[model samples]
Target: MAHETSETTAASSVDAAASSGRRFLRNKVPEVTVSFWIIKVLCTTVGKTAADLLGEKAGHGLTGVSVLMSVLLAVVLVVQFRTTAYRAGVYWSAVALISVVGTLISDSLTDGMGVPLETSATVFAIMLAAVYVVWYRRERTLSIHSIDTTGRESFYWLAVLLTISLSSATGDLVSERMDFGYWLSAVLFALLIAAIALAHFALDLDAVWSFWIAYVLTRPLGASFGDYLSQPTDDGGLGLGTVVTSVLFLGVVLGLVVYPAVTRKDVTQLHQAARQAA
Candidate 1:
């Protein structure tokens, strides 16, 4: 009887471990908050500055930079898709790379192919709208909270790519064509984002609408701030250079990712509470 009980207990433990692993893998989305937004903006700023530094300052040229970044983004995205759980470093690296690639796509269309900003902006907007319509039609919901399924994840990333591309073209058009300058453009987008937030919290806008609006606005806000810091004084910027801006933002993102990795305090606490209740 003692031997049989020991074997059964061991089997039960193994089964429990497997179950726990499966649950962990299924929790795909991160806990959204202020920290998430702050890091996202930092990544966007790095994306703009790093892409420009590589193409213009480092002599990589537009085609070379676009090709290289596009390949890199694809590799990172593959890694992200393969992972069963949310690894902050892998996920955020993919985001940063995609941001750069998205900006490059818009820049190449405008500078290399001579496509008008208005046209690029409109094309991206239509693409994004189509993505949402299809995503909703299939998934029946647009909540970030439930990104565990493969189809939802695909839609989420597609929308993200479109938003970045559209924002890049629109930001450039407003700052350059309208002569609003980088700082003013940043302020304008910030206020627009703030209003969206107000509408979500105070006026009870749909959660999906609030999330998408905020996501789109962050791109322009990040781009404007990036240009304000990196462009020359004659262009109404601080002339900090792309390398410095990239380094600063990259360092912050690395630190934030590392903190969550090492501590794992957030994950641990949540799991512990779940176990206690169970």
Candidate 2:
């Protein structure tokens, strides 16, 4: 009886380990790293500049650009959802496109619909909060590390969409409506992100909350930075034009994402057998 029980327990352990490994493999997001943040900031910057390029510079008008980008974002999101694991190319592509689409959503509220940036920011904040409430209630956790199911992934993307919109509105409110200008606004957001990082490392802030806060702040910081570089000198920018700024940032993001994809360096690692045994 002891011998039989031992064999059964070993089989159970093996099965649990395999199940844990499968769960890890199914996670749809990359492991957070320094490269992740760099690529994210660049993606946000490209989001701002590329939206401007299409809407104003390309003569597509805001409505046209919004529609076009929304469709593209939807397509990319479908691909993202279908993937069983995180593919750097697909994941970052979705992020970049969503950034543009999110910017367009905010701009549409402000410019097309005559909504004040303050009002848009407030609404988006409420919506983001609601998403969190629902997500946590359903999943019992908001950690990105647990994004291994379609339902969790849905919540994650919805939260991301709101964050992007909220960030755009907040950035515009500070930089344009409040007369802070682009560069100064970038500095302010950068400082805020740094403070969050400090709190996480030194003050023992919750890791998940720290990550989300930094994620939200990066959107505005990158947007302000992009605007500062692309807007004309008279508008407190270097006058590089949106085209130049978008292309430059996109190139950097592509290179960074490609390296990780090739090397799998940023792939989340899990000691599945140990975890399962525990």
Candidate 3:
């Protein structure tokens, strides 16, 4: 009876480990797709204009708006993390809030505390690199496909936030400090993203790195694009105003998200490619 009991206990332990491992491998995020990129860029554009509108137009100082928006962001993120499966509404809401907070962080350092754009960009770049190093060291993979575990998801969100800050800083450095017109800056980043896509498709770039490179560049691209429409002609823009730009882009984002939500097209499946074997 004692021997039989010992065998059963060992088997149960094995079963439990297997179950945990399986759960850890199941992705809880959306799959990379065309819709993903479209929504990502649109949300990033909103990040730029919405932050400005809330801070300047909405009758709140940057600090006050940041605090209010941060509270709302916390609630949205809590819902996102508590979900067991990928949810388009929850996921995109989190992304949008991250975009807003990221803009606030970058702007606060530069406009609020007198940090130079170059300095902020360089600092954010280093911070992003550090996150990547620590993440890769612990998980041995930096691919977004394996963000099923709590630790990986945390790392993913941290990376996303850092990337947005870095991108915002860099965008301002090129488009404002350097005095490149908003339209020109938009063209510049669009070309850069095109190059990355070419490298991925034509030259056989690593899929994970390609995805991330494009992702980082889109931040600046969207910022420039947003500013081009929202800023006045005196500043080399289309003079649409923030209200129009925000409403237009957000409507598009809503449409794109609805399609994916109803179709379940972007939901990550139970078994997908992983970097572990590489």
What lDDT tens digits, residue by residue, belong to model 1 across residues 115-135?
999999999999999999999
Candidate No. with top lDDT: 2
Clashes in model 2: which pairs?
Answer: none
Q: Mark the 10 consecutive residues where model 1 has the least summed lDDT.
A: 1-10
Per-residue lDDT of candidate 3, residues 223-269 (tens digit): 99999999999999999999899999999999999998898778643
Sorting all predicted structures by lDDT, with the top scorer first, yields 2, 3, 1
Q: After superposition, how far is residue 171 of candidate 3 from its true place, in Å?
A: 0.5
Better candidate number, 1 or 2, judged by lDDT = 2
**What C-alpha lDDT values do all the predictions have?**
0.80, 0.86, 0.83
TM-score of each: 0.86, 0.89, 0.88
Clashes counted in candidate 3 amount to 0
Cα TM-score of candidate 2: 0.89
Residue 21, model 1, lDDT: 70
By TM-score, the best candidate is 2
